[model samples]
Target chain A: MATTSRVARPRLSSTGDALRPDSNGSTRERLTALAFIAPALLGFAVFYFWPTLRGVYFSFTEYDVFNAPVFVGLDNYRALFADATFGNAMLVTVEYVAINIISQTVLALLIAVLLHRVTRSVFVRSIVVMPYLVANVVVALLFYWMLDAQIGITNQFLGWLGIEPVAFFGDQNLAIPTIALVNTWRHVGYTALLLFAGMVMIPHDVYEAGRVDGASEWKMFWRITLPLLRPVLALVLVITVVGSFQAFDTVAVTTAGGPGDASRVIQYYIFDLAFQRLQFGYASAVSVVLFVILAAVALVQLKLMRAGESDVA
Target chain B: MATTAAAPLDTEALLDRSAGGGGRPRRGPGRILAWVALVLIMAATLFPFLWMIRTAFSNGAALSTQPASLLPVEPTLGAFRRVLGLASTEEAQAQGGSGAAIDFGRYLLNSVLVSVLITAGQVFFGALAAYAFARLRWPGRDTVFFLFLTALMVPPIFTQLPNFLLMRDLGLLNTYAAIVLPFFFMTPFAIFFLRQFFLGIPHEVEEAARLDGAGPLRRFFGVILPMASGPITTLAILQYVQAWSEYFWPLLVASEENVRVLTVGLGIFRAQTPQGTPDWSGMMAGTLLAALPVLLLFAVFSRKIVNSIGFSGVK
Candidate 1:
């Protein structure tokens, strides 16, 4: 049906073009697009939009899985503010996000710049992406063994340096950073690929112009590549910050938010509240708070990114 | 834009160094360091997976040996056999925890079934939606499409509990439906991806078919789909890997042994450990085996995986 309409359109357009100068070909275009997009729109509405609205509504109500929600007004919200665990979770999450964005972004930028200078071999690119492909569970489990403190390879390596064994995950102070470092290692390959793509899209003429201007390698990079790469960097920062806030599975697998909640991210905290404590209403309230925090942060970052780009321009 | 191409003296010196390509001045220290850094990154990535494989096979007693061997001294299929339940769930059971009772066979079957259904649904329904979005004209098209994009920002955690409630209300909890239904329909990301590829294709190809009287359905099935094979194949591989590795949702939904996926089964195993110490050997064995499908997928299609991520990230 769409093809028939599409087929009819050109002939119709010619007739319309000849007879009616006002015809814009808009109707045919719209119908054809509607046919293509309807299914996606329907599915998105049911699975995504409706649920998102439902989530927000449920945040204000008290309900268990067995019963319909009973409106409790701002009670859940009040308890959320009063909860000490919630406070700790907020602090830990902010710290985690800060650590993740800084470390991962810096490493990704460095690797991307380095890889850009190297040969653009397919094999090299594949090797660079290999770490990102490994499942989070596998990485967490692997690190668990490697950082086992006594029988672990990390301690064994330290032993050779004649240093005492260090419990990487066992110590409260070391736990979050160790996890953060591992997170950085797993993500840098993936992030580098993003930066590399941005690098490749840069026109060669710009680099050549920089070369002709007697720019040093460092100067050329700072002046030419970094500015061109702004969009990708902004993208990486947005996704990284958002992802850090949502960190759950790795902590679940590795630390179980342990060493007394040192590594407990907001997602993990939410999970414990909803599942373990069975505080469905309170968790919903927490989720609402999280949603607000993320939205504010994203909006601010987006504004900053646009402002920075405009400044560069 | 106009300037000298570096100082003539500097270019001449650099060119001379480049000309001595094989011995003392062949590769600069910079180039060597670059290669070294590349090699180190590769090692860092590969080392954990290698260690997992070795540790999975190493005997518990041998693992405790001083100055532990990186390679298992007596590498055995013992762990693999135990995990596959070709030996006995008893060895696993003796090791104790939720794993002791875990039926690896059931979990494997559950994972395979769920992954297959989700992949099939995403390809079929997602293609239909993507095709519509790509080719068919509609009212409020971009507005509606952007609405779908906003769904990406809602975060999975937001939908997770509500969906579970929906499943519970439907009495589909503890069933595969709970795990599969939310993902079975068209997703915004997949729609956007397929639409991007579809938009790049010239209308002339479809127009030619239309002129030859090929129906819309016929053109879609015979032409558009075949042309869109690369993205479809890539999406399938990704959706499969994702479904196979998913932990939290499955844990939340499926409580029965028969419905348990590998991730939840591992979780149960983790929970069942006696005292403070976990059954490290058994747990590692299970964890390694559980990651096998994704590992295999990654090994086979690292390029596609990376390219897809890059593509999505940029968009």
Candidate 2:
């Protein structure tokens, strides 16, 4: 079964003999392939490729919404370096990404472990996954309402315990963390589902062997499951980090980067510059910076995972 | 590939092991504690939606009471009626102040139309491209596929400024085309996902179709597509949900009421409400209405959705 399945796998990256120049069907097959692929390629070029190239070009020029772009080499980057708000946004974004990664990963892993040990029914699992299906705007609005200082149920619950109603979106020091907590609440279920899938992929004999050796569940998980789950853990980390960096929808709905830019992450900052301030060139420069950071992180993650695979092999 | 093969077996083994009663007994204090913790987690996760429902069903006066009611106090469909434009003008004025009436029905229709079109377009084009990449041996296939994969790393925000500028240049702003065109045809993620599904299909089936003198299109439509219904359905649902819930791009391109989607419409409603004295019940009603479709989609196809997520992550 394994060998036949392996043989059946489509080789997407190779040229089969049927398509070689000497083959009788090569020309017809090539024409068919191009016809099949034309629509997607056209859309990709128009939407993705052209925009990306223009974005890079705009990063180097000075342009606003009204006028033509004037070429200025590296001036935008220099101004970005000297800008205080940009620096603050960078710091806040890094902080947000770090806190989000830690909290979401830990909570998701915990839930996945618990679920693996306890539940087997899809119904129970779906209840937990429900929050992830809600729109970001909806989640943000729901939490905004639930955390309202005067009439929110969260504060009401707190008041019953003799605590004052905290303004979740008002205070600068608490706003970013509050948003992070809400973001975590929105995403933890999906993350847990990913990790749960990874956990269930492990072979059963390993657990049987550990049990036969009188290892407790805790020991078995730490000694056996953790090592095997490293690749998936890396995957989860990469995805969450990339997502948190680009987060804008929730912030837009809940805070609009406001109460004096306390929760202004990079994406929101870029939107403010491009749309609100009309500094298209500067926004593109900031976008370039964000792209570099994300690309670097993704490359490092892929390399690390590849190295781990080689070690196992 | 190895893990994929092992996963189904692991599930079966897990079921058999638990049912055969070898490792640990089911009744214990620890087990009870685990169940308690699970239930608590479930409650915490679901509490916000419950609050939305509570607020959605109540009227302004009931919500404005000193302590908010956990249950609907004056249960009325007044907010829904107002949102859907089913209420009379006098009825709307009697409910609340300036923020009572919005063209929410138009927004709902716009959202539905844009989302369905984008989903159908994306799934169709994505499957065509994925089929070519998965089955046909063509020059530059790998390079083109790799290029598509690279788009995954380029943040959507990076392209937003240029795409918006392009829309403005073409005089497409405030039109549904502006909101729908950029994403209507194909996305890198969808193509990649469909390609993976296509690769998993056995080559023998396509060979059989070819032997029967079916053309490439016929083989794809008749042979491959029937086998791909699971992944295609998953992709369609996902794309629909995503297009429906999108906020940022729509907020940029389609700020006009005629083309406004639910998420942006809800945001506009929130902004129009007076700060520190928000129309909480109205905003909650808008949110509940916006969230209802995707939530219903989940209620029906949650297992397939979850499985697709797992497949994407693991694969």
Candidate 3:
């Protein structure tokens, strides 16, 4: 595949040559390569490899940090299966994920389309993404203050319009939606940029050919843009859904899963079970369940979207 | 570099209006409406964000009085003083801050130290591993790199408890080691990112370095790494932002005051709300302090960041 050509390919275009192992696989070369990868491999084996296996292993055993782990085989899973709190958490997490994915994908699509028309300068692009550049805790605190019922800027502004003050985080019914909205504010810009990337990749000749055939802008968008945009939308959905499931900092800082367990999503539930109640085994079981669900969700989504298939289709 | 605070908006030329035939300009009511709606949306999205800066500069006592004011209420630096621990407890309470101190200056230092160490170590080792994968021919090289990539699919929550117990067993909990070690080593994403770049580099130069009798390490440091300064810088910026803004891992292991990073510090500040009203002004000031480094870095390298935008599903 490398062709043994003298003139190199363009600097960024990827080639499949990596799949072909080098012809000279001498022992000295192998040892040198091993040495090169050793430090990273050490880190990978320790932090990622060992910890992941140990985490799953810990789920089947009972350990209190004070004593050796006692193997309890499926008890943690059985308890979690019947746990109402876990059920509530999963439901709440799904509720949170649904709101976040739909709103973020739609809003980010809007922003990207608009910016594609107006300007795409790095300065303007950077401004839109600035909110996303900070920690979730920053925006969480920011919106938490602005949305405060009593004297928050949002409520104060709403009062000018003669509307009653609404409790965003304080009301159980409003808490989950508010969390989703807050994260949307943080992410919509970045997701817009992500969609914009997908838009930029669509070949110019596709649109040129459309215009030559007298296709209107709206017509072109429907026929050309939306179909091409599907894979990107799927990607943003998977990303936002996964991150939304693990939404912790905002919940931790703003509501702390309060207002009567309305905002107690699964990740927060895992955290509380482990740290607050010191039930490490139950928490690990919950994590395994979450991992499985997330993996299944990702697989289902990729399959449904037919990612990496023809954009025109 | 597709890690966090700001990821590779990795796909370049994000808004290439000129490239598309649909970018045609036409005067119409629909265009006007679209423009107006764009302004409105940008306004609604960005307008509320200014509240943090406005509140940070205002005295805490004035927030209750001027909750909706355009200019800062009783514009003062007292809240910042309160966060930085420059004000005494009496002064803090008198100015509507909690009596407990936040000491953001100390946390800022911790954040800088921690973020730098992570970026430096992660980039260096990640680059090495990436080189091996990209430039060297060896047994199981691709397989090993594929295994490293599998770790990217494992969420931080899945490994949270085991890592915690490992740290506790090693007596490193509440220390910087626990806060740093989990990410201090190579991240799969980091390796993947560097390997992609390393693969793109002209093999001619590396071949010349080899002919000069340079060893593997020498060729790496002397030739390839220097040639990769552009991507390396991009990776470092992305990695630094991620390291600085990390919340979950640090929150789990190093919630103690001294080792606390700015994010966890801000959380604690928010949690310590006084009896009546939350310390809105003081907490906002802390948030500003926490966010400044990342924002400043973005401002400095925004063009570099924007030009390097690639979507690798980094979140």
Q: Which predicted model would earn the best DockQ?
A: 2
lDDT for position A100 in model 3:
85
| Cα lDDT tens digits for candidate 3, B188-298 | 767766776677677777778878988777888899899889888888887888888788888989989899999999988888883478888898898988888888898
Task: List the lowest-lDDT window of 10 residues for candidate 2 chain A.
Answer: A1-10
What's the TM for chain B in candidate 3? 0.91
- Report how far off residue B228 is in candidate 1 (Å): 0.9
Per-residue lDDT of model 1, residues B258-282, tens digit only: 7888877776666675245555566
DockQ of 1: 0.30
Model 2, B211-291: lDDT tens digits are: 899888888899999998877888898788878878889999999988888998888888876455676777788889888
True contacts kept of 1: 0.36
Worst 10 residues of 2 chain B by lDDT: B1-10
Residue pairs of candidate 2 with colliding backbone atoms = none
Docking class of 2: acceptable
Q: How accurate is candidate 3 locally (lDDT)?
A: 0.78
What clash count goes with each model?
17, 0, 6
Put down candidate 3 lDDT per residue, A90-190, tens digits, no spaces.
99999998898789888888878766655565666787778888888899999999999998988988999999999999998999999999998888888
Task: Compose the digit string of candidate 1's lDDT tens values, residues A200-308.
Answer: 6555556666656766557867887798777557656766787778887678877888889888889899889778887777777788788888777766766666665
The DockQ of each candidate is: 0.30, 0.45, 0.44
